[model samples]
Target: MTPYDAPLPQAPAAPALIDGFGRQVTYLRVSVTDRCDLRCVYCMAEHMTFLPKREVLTLEELDRIASAFVTLGVRKLRITGGEPLVRKGVMGLFENLSRHLRSGALDELTLTTNGTRLAEFAADLARLGVRRVNVSLDTLKPDLFRQLTRGGDLAKVIAGIDAAQGAGLSVKINAVALKDDNAAELPDLIAWAHGRGLEATLIEAMPLGEIEYDRTDQFLSLKAVRSHLESFWTLTETDHRTGGPARYVRVEETGGRLGFITPLTHNFCEACNRVRLTCTGTLHSCLGRDDASDLRAVIRAGADDAALKNAIRRAVDAKPKGHDFQIARAAAPAVSRHMSTTGG
Candidate 1:
């Protein structure tokens, strides 16, 4: 076994993780690869050059880093990417995680995908011990789907969602509220997801990275989304909170639950309990800030498990009190890294 495959060090007390802000950091988001099948308007530019295979983290490196966090009390791990499923041998990664990480140490091992490949991997994912899956789908209309995702098949995504449910996996739909795009479809989208027992999450578009569209013009506040949905439905607060920052509600009439992730209208940093490890192995303290620790370099330098764990602790200690996205302008020099590079 390599240094990364070494066993954990001596265990700490019950509370193993504490950030600089005195918050319990228990969730970790890891991006597997910086390659995607579809290029959406808000997520990435059209002509993006994908990362070389040599630059991204290997399965062993991911296991080592993730196991370090787990030993430190990170109970929930979400595998994300430009599109996680597009990466080959993803099921093998899930197998390693299931064998080592999720067999009781982790509370949940989930994934966030663009929903294009769910049909091909859903059954295997459920069999491999995934807790749940969140599929990013902005619109239901075929033409609008193609326009937004730059040539994605709406039927395939819908089929993928159905495939996940058919495999008995809990699914949630993630939709970003773009002002002139799918903002008006919130009620219908939530209703549609509810019809199939999936929660529809309306996310506020954060001004991050270089985009093909005018991000500011497309930015729809959660306040505006609430008002729009209230005109057509009665939404009462629900207690279905999770590790993420999405605030939730239930439809009074249809019993459909809706979620709002408002990085723009209402900041949820106080309850933020997670950290992101980009595909390039940069441990980002905050999504809105580019400050990161190069864990990959440390690991490749032959650090043992103890040293690796120390690096993780040091990175956690660097966690900021909050993000600057709340006051960030669209054109400002904040969060220049695209979502593809960073993960969900």
Candidate 2:
């Protein structure tokens, strides 16, 4: 067939899916790789073993899976990773998927990165249709940054944020507020992000897996953090709400916005509309719970699109109402896989 004479291909059929809470899951968080440059204390401890390279999904495989999800009513896609930028050919993957984004095949294309390598890839990512970026930067002080990240360069993260903004991508700075460490820097971080036209988000420290200290000590609630910040900035409530976890508010007079994710104090599970796809190809219905359904095995077994969609539907039907960290702690002490592995 001649180039212009070939018939157009038929669009893929949509799949039936349901979330753990029985909600129609329409969002997908895909972890491209389990390898990250920084070893954030909460995500992974020092001296952790990286996933085998062979076990990681290839770019083509990732695109195929994402395409299938998009066909199955996945309107939004977030590229996550141990750090997604660390993966090779990620730009190419975005480029390949961009073609299928017409007709609202994807409503939002976003990414959550540690911001270590974003400086180098921001421009490329912007050109590839990435609309927003959430960078995990907890502290501004170089010493504390190094201490928290365990040998990571804070300058690189700062540069990445700047680069992302320069590339025209909407930026949100994610800060995990600890009790003593960098908790006091909230005002400065807010001022800095506002000055740069970026949103600053303060996230409560979650007890995911094995870490260095007690969960209680590291657990800084949103109320405590907001109490400290309310003294400095005239915090005005915002009606704006995104599908993600953060509760957003605007800073009066500064033209900057702040967000708080209080998973412990104020859980937003009822409005939770997210589902995570792990790097190993398992579909996790909830981040707090360890329950997951294996999609990789089904794909590898030569399952057709109908079979694959059935697997996705079954996975969502198995989604939990919410995580039971409290009960898990009281009971058998359920330890979760690291956040990076879970694509948080």
Candidate 3:
């Protein structure tokens, strides 16, 4: 067995992570790296400073921490980043984590990426037991895409999506609905994804961190986007859920599913079962709240599995019932940290 998969000593069964509000924390989103190949206007600043290599947790440490959560009943783990694929040797982490899937300790292992490198790693990711991926694509227009991403190529992302589908991995197109940018393209984008038998999810622009531009001008409510879509397509609500915040609906015209994540217009914190782990080993119990627990220090302190698990449980215990995310003129973000640092 790999070092990460070495069996742990037998101990009493650890209780599942249930927050104070009675929400079970079954999902964990881990950011492997804070670096990205593209700078989406909504996600990061054009000029960004990333964490140093030593400050970030090693792959072995990430595995141990993730394994502890799995032992505590985290069923799904999503490896995220500014771009997870850009991190060197990331596939090795996937391989190590797949052991959980093999042993039935984990139900799913996946990621959310910019799709800039999916063409190069899709097959390997599929082979490592990743069944699906969420590709963040804001716009399809070549010029507009580059302008929004500050140099991202739309063709490369589309090619990567094709390659991922070719490798038998289900693709979910996650587009951030911006009023001044991709709002008009929502119908076309959803149709394009549905046309390909892919799922399309639109997210309202969240006020996460400081960017070069203001978010108030860009914030487009998914509630309005849904009303607009209903004018053309037949949208019927479905009871489908993917263990994340997005609520799904079946589009009758395209015969595909559509999802909406309205963190601003709609508060979805009532059933929050997920926690975020940054690359530096910080545990954020709530994405919209600034409170955090330093898991990196705990790991580096040479804590045993039991101790690590206790730290995680303590973090979960303090998880807020909901986040207070708001966007307004000349107002700072509700959370100062970038979504990348918090595992988008």
The top-ranked prediction according to lDDT is: 3
* Tens-digit per-residue lDDT, 115-192, candidate 3: 989999999999999999999988789999999888989999999999999999999999999999888998999999
Q: Kindly give the number of clashing pairs for every candidate.
A: 0, 1, 0
Question: Once model 2 is optimally superposed onto the true structure by TM-score, how far is the C-alpha of residue 121 displaced, in angstroms?
Answer: 0.9
In candidate 2, how many Å is residue 188 off?
Answer: 1.2
The count of backbone overlaps in candidate 3 is 0
Pitting candidate 2 against candidate 3, the one with the higher TM-score is 3
RMSD of 1: 4.5
Model 3 whole-model lDDT (C-alpha atoms): 0.94
Candidate 2, lDDT over the whole model: 0.81
**Per-residue lDDT value at 284 in model 2:** 85
Give me the runs in candidate 2 sitting further than 4 Å from their true place. 1-16, 20-22, 327-334
Rank by TM-score, highest first. Answer: 3, 1, 2
Residue-level lDDT tens digits of model 1 in 1-344: 99999998965554567888888899999999888899888888999988888899998888889888887889888999989999888888888887644457888888999998999999999998885899999998999999999999999898899899999899999999888988878778888899888888889887678766667778888897798778878889989987899989998877777889887678788877999998888999788888899999999999998898888888888898878774344466368889889998
Better lDDT candidate (2, 3): 3
Residue-level lDDT tens digits of model 2 in 1-344: 79899888986666446665657777889999888889888778788787897677778778878878888888889999889988888888888887667566788788999999988999988887887899998888899999888999999988888899899999998989887787678788879888988888998777676766565766677898788777877889998765687888889968988999987788677777778988888888887778888888888889988788788888888888876554223333234677888786
